[model samples]
Target: MEGLVDINRLASGEAGRALLERVFQDDSERFLRRLRDRVDRVGIDLPAIEVRYQGLSVQVDAFVGSRALPTLWNSATNFLQFD
Candidate 1:
């Protein structure tokens, strides 16, 4: 399924976000490999795959409710367990 799954298309609702999270959690190595190969094939010497992977990981984490920050100041302090 080369080039079949567009990650952008999966950034919609909860289910799509969940699917993206699972994809990264399951086989992130393969995903990065394919991403690098595709980018290299296009003759683009952009950022390292590891760097891109880190950014993607952060994005996925936010979508999956892991890296989200509280909106209110009090809530932020409570969320972080600060005294």
Candidate 2:
């Protein structure tokens, strides 16, 4: 897999209640290790990405089905929640 699996593709609308699921059903340890490695590469320097906010806005969500992007609950009005 080139990227992480989108769990919302399962479309249950809730998170963290399942003890196990289809995602990571095979080789979860390797999957998680890869995940950690990917995460480690992000945001090492704050100033490097400060301009990212200059042209940003909340998404209008025109897609009707599963999105490839794992959409977070973004707060259009709350800057603190951007994390």
Candidate 3:
């Protein structure tokens, strides 16, 4: 819970799984709030903002999706190596 949490280790336990979920939820909310503030400060119209938000969301989804496969592969390989 302090520094450098290993996702594979965290996923292995109930408490760690809950903590990971909470962390991700909090991070996502924080990111949206910051994005909203930035758009407001820039005086973007609602329609334009929505477009930008959609673009940002797609990028984030793609980025996270891209990394997930590699992370899972590495985790499995690591577990196999250790086991």
Which candidate ranks first by TM-score, i.e. highest? 3
What does candidate 3's lDDT look like per residue over 1-83, in tens digits? 57886799878899988988999999999999999999999988776333334435333223345444668776686567659
> Model 1, stretches more than 4 Å misplaced?
1-3, 29-83
Candidate 2 per-residue lDDT, tens place, 1-83, comes to 87875655644544532423544565687888887777678735333444345667786634334433345533332334444
Question: What TM-score would candidate 3 get against the native?
Answer: 0.50
lDDT of 1 by residue, 1-83 (tens): 77686768776878999988887777988888899899889989786555334435333222235334555764675656645
Ranking 2 against 3 by TM-score, winner: 3
What order do you get sorting by TM-score, best first? 3, 1, 2
lDDT of each: 0.69, 0.52, 0.76
Model 2 residue 55 CA deviation (Å) reads 48
Candidate 2 residue spans exceeding 4 A from truth: 1-26, 44-83
Ranking of predictions according to lDDT: 3, 1, 2
Relative to the unseen true structure, what is the C-alpha lDDT of residue 64 in candidate 2, on a scale of 0 to 100? 38
Off by over 4 Å in 3: 1-3, 48-83
